[model samples]
Target: MAEGLRTAYQLEEDDIATILPEEEDKFNGEEFNKQFLQFDRDRIQKINQKGKEKFEQGYSKAKKEVLDQLETEARERFGVEDDELRGIDLIDHIVEINSKKSKADPTKLTEEQIKSHPSVIKLLNEKEKSFKTREEELKTEYDTKLNNFQKERTFSAVEKKALAIFDKMNPVLSSDPERAANQKSILINDLKGLDYQEDGDTYIPLQEGKRLEDPHGNGVSFEKLVQSRAARYFDFKKAEERDTPPAGGGDGGATGFPKTEAEYAKIVNDQNIPLEERLEIKKKWNEAKSQS
Candidate 1:
């Protein structure tokens, strides 16, 4: 029975072997599984590397196509072409060409050509306008300087004439330089309100508005006005009176009582007399006159 059982199991094994092919003795199932997994990994890695290379090539081609399109558009629009220049460089070149054309000489062109070039006409018009403006400015400057010079000359002439009138009116002023200067200044100020009439090449001082008359009811001359006004402001005496010695003082020219009109005049005209003594002398003169 054991022998028969062994034979039956062998037959079953033979039948299984026929259905499933047996591997060679050197083939290991575990090792073959490992090798198959490694091969799949290497294949996937190669596919990924090929895909990356294709993507890089596509990107480079797209970038070159875009740059070429831009250059074509720029050249067509600007009417300029250069293989070495692209984008902004092409634009700058076009601007330089147009600038040169704008600056072209109108003198070398025909009338019709010059009229057609409006930029040249505009530049010439602007230059002409600038020249006219400069001319107007120079004229204005010259007129202003001439006006100022005329004003100065007129003022100097007026002052010189005023000083001469003042000197003639007051002989005291001629000897005293400081007093002469002061009186001339005052006379000039008074004359500032007067009008001036053109007299030959010079001007004559004429009174304006309300005219002033002297005590004799006659129109006052400039000289008479200066003399009267000076007398009003200053106490002027004859030069001889100022130099003469006082009388009746025991040979010392000291002030004393006055007996006559000349003695009284001398005492009063003497500036060296004390104010109190002068007052006393005046009181004595009044008393003597009353008693008579």
Candidate 2:
């Protein structure tokens, strides 16, 4: 009976194997599998998105700390913001006023100069051109501000000790404020990345780059030690502006753009120009006329 049962089971398996793949009565297995894979993929995608958001939030906070300081400096020292004053024209006005009045520093500005500066008056007169030009400069400044991706881990004890050691190794760095700042920046990056071992009275670094293996070690991570050196994204944007020829090509020439209202009027009325280019010129002329 057992042998007969075994033979019957074997024959059933053989019959199942003999059945055509197309005829198999699968319980929506292909659909279920596809859905299962897609579900996990969607979850992973969401997780990645969340991670990016978290990183951006942290970075933004750090950058805001840096920016708030600059804004405070601008507001308290410069007195720049008002109803009419805005953008680089305002800054230029401030700078010019500061330059004329102050003895020590030339950048400290006051609110009164916003209206009085010759450059400021000129900017207000040519608002459109100045607005467009300064807007481009602002874009360049914003692009350069894209740094601080992964911030350094700094401890007071480490910094104090590092500074002591750093001054001994390089004593001539702090002759001027700018050189001192650059020196400090370079030293802090190097000191933070070192893993140290004590020898009686002195601290000695294990290596230049690697952190100590022990969990209890007093070493900063290699990444935390160095300042990020990312290249400016879209640096070519401002460079492109510098590379651009002056309006109507350096020397006096036909810029293919009508400079005067009379020129625009003549070009728009002329039938010799192509219909598309003429239409463009007419539309531009009408817009310029309205603005004027």
Candidate 3:
């Protein structure tokens, strides 16, 4: 019976072997598992190293390209040489002098010693003076250019408002040649309302005075309305005079008459002016035309 049992077990082993390859002689299951884990860790480390190397290479290339482009642009746009653009070499000289001083005996730094190191002192002084000179030059250039730009293109809101008021008064004033001529000085005097005491050039509207409460209850100056009207008239007259060039280069010139009586009638009909003043201006205009 024991012999029969051994034969049956051997036959079963043979059948299993025939169905599958024999277990690998070198396969220690636990050792193989540990080896697989170490293989994975090594692969991960290699991948990280490659990634870091690529990142470093890209960064270095970008930095070099950017620096080269900046240098090229500076040279092209500003005519700055590489040496000049690198900044003054005085700093290197200063560092050298400071280093030497650090090594020298502090107690022995006499006037003679300082004078002997004249090159360092001269370089320091030259650097300071050159910096100051360059700063002053830049400031002056900026101010000059800014002023020219302002003069050519800038206008304050007050100036624009004043000009608009002047335009509105133009036709009325131009209608009466005699009144425009005779009262021109008075009209100029009336412009005092437009003149703010601040910078003395700006003109705010007369309505702005309503905002201020006077302690004496004096209220808004009644003169403001008269002044504004007169100022507008005067500005128009001045513009017209400028447009009408002097004949024969002298103050005495022919007064150009209005083309028609209807033109003068328009000023006589404007409602903004006092009825009495409008009528008076019209009468004077008629008299001037009759004399002409």
Query: lDDT of candidate 3 vs native?
Result: 0.44
Tens digits of per-residue lDDT for model 1 on 126-212? 545655565566556556765664454465556556555544442444334455456556656765666554456446445554455
Q: Assess candidate 2 and give its TM-score to the true structure.
A: 0.22
lDDT of 2 by residue, 92-120 (tens): 64666567665634444465755666655
Give candidate 2 regions above 4 Å deviation.
1-34, 53-65, 79-90, 102-292
Worst 10 residues of 3 by lDDT: 249-258
Give candidate 3 misplaced runs (Cα > 4 Å).
1-116, 147-156, 169-292
Worst 10 residues of 2 by lDDT: 227-236
Scored by CA lDDT, what does every candidate get? 0.53, 0.46, 0.44
How many pairs of residues collide in each model? 0, 0, 0
Instruction: Output candidate 1 Cα RMSD.
Output: 53.8
Residues 1-292 of candidate 3 have per-residue lDDT tens digits of 1232235222244433433233333334476446544543564476557755765565555555544554454345434444454322433333345546579654456556554565545544654565556556655655675555343222233333443444355433544545644554454344433333223444323334443224665533423443445555444344545323234421211132234677445645544344444545555565766887
Q: Find the 10 residues in a row with the least total lDDT in model 1.
A: 1-10
- Between prediction 1 and prediction 2, the one with superior lDDT is 1
Clashing pairs in 2: none
